[model samples]
Target chain A: AQTVTQSQPEMSVQEAETVTLSCTYDTSESNYYLFWYKQPPSRQMILVIRQEAYKQQNATENRFSVNFQKAAKSFSLKISDSQLGDTAMYFCAFMNIGGSQGNLIFGKGTKLSVKP
Target chain B: EPEVTQTPSHQVTQMGQEVILRCVPISNHLYFYWYRQILGQKVEFLVSFYNNEISEKSEIFDDQFSVERPDGSNFTLKIRSTKLEDSAMYFCASIPPGLAGEQFFGPGTRLTVL
Candidate 1:
């Protein structure tokens, strides 16, 4: 069974600063996909960034990026130039490359606070 | 940009009552899925539907739960009898191409079983 773990339950960063949220997963399949999602107090899950297992290049989206260490099974999200609007619950998710069921397995989530 | 839309942003019902959550995935999408998140808990997968049938489901998706694409546009999840523990935010997502593709999520419906 594949499981995603977000060790950090909460995180805080000053506006204009940077913060990183840690994530790890257990998967036997070599080919898969990793994702970072942000859910605000409204409880809407929004896709932030995605990383393909086969790509050594980490994924970057404007201000959000990922440091994907496949060997260690670590996929961490880094938010640079953090803003107040960035405060939300962040989740790490996993999905198989090819399967009939394309559902994503998500972590417990990390509550992020962007302090001004 | 096209997005998935779910109806009844919030629903409160007595325990043992039946509740149906509806979602309209992107028109071009093929695979649809349902996930739930209990307050302060991880988002858990419930079931996946494709080709108008269930492709897969989790242990949490027991006999009490069923999904249907009754029409060409809408997807629905019906709980035979809602329980207190079933109260959570239900999310509806759809995969644009197929597996290996990114999934787009809906705003989610908060189900409160009282």
Candidate 2:
């Protein structure tokens, strides 16, 4: 069984500032994938960024990046140059790349508010 | 961009009534999945479908729940008898064969069981 934990229940950042959302997971599988998803007021789940366990280098997608520490089982999402549109409930997810099922295990989520 | 789409953006049903939620996954997607998120709770996986059959299911997907791909572009999840506990936002997702871990999700159907 795998579990994802988002210790921060809420986070706030001023417009144009940077924010980091913390996430940790417990998984026995060595080969896996970590993802960050954003859910806006519309409740549409959108992929922010993804990092593979085998890839030592972190994943970056424009303003969204991930700080993945495989040894510590930590995968945090960083939003640089944050904008009002970045306000949303962010979730950290885990998936097994080699399993029969590719279902995602998600964290409770961290609600981010980008204040102007 | 290609994306998954779900029908009946919102559904309201009485207890013991049957309800069906429909989705149209990405045209080229090979893997389909259903997930639900209760109010103020984490998203939970319900089932995964591939090859016109269910390949994996969670314990929460009891006999009361069923999934089908009735047509070439439609995927549906039906609840035999709705319960108050079943009220939540149901989401449909799909993954292309080439993208092993990327699952694109739909906007989600909000189910309200009273």
lDDT of 1 by residue, B33-102 (tens): 9999999999999999989999999999999999999999999999978999999999999997646468
Query: Residue A4 in candidate 1 has what lDDT?
Result: 94
lDDT of 1 by residue, A2-115 (tens): 999998999999999999999999989887999999999999999999999999999999999999999999999999999999999999999986654768999999999999
lDDT of 2 by residue, B48-106 (tens): 99999999999999999999999999999999889999999999999999458889999
Evaluated on the second chain alone, the candidates' TM-scores are: 0.97, 0.98
Residue A36's C-alpha lDDT in candidate 1? Answer: 95
Give the root-mean-square deviation of each candidate in angstroms: 0.9, 0.9
Docking quality tier of model 2: high
The window of 10 residues in a row where model 2 chain A has the poorest summed lDDT is A95-104
Candidate 2 residue runs with Cα over 4 Å from true position: none
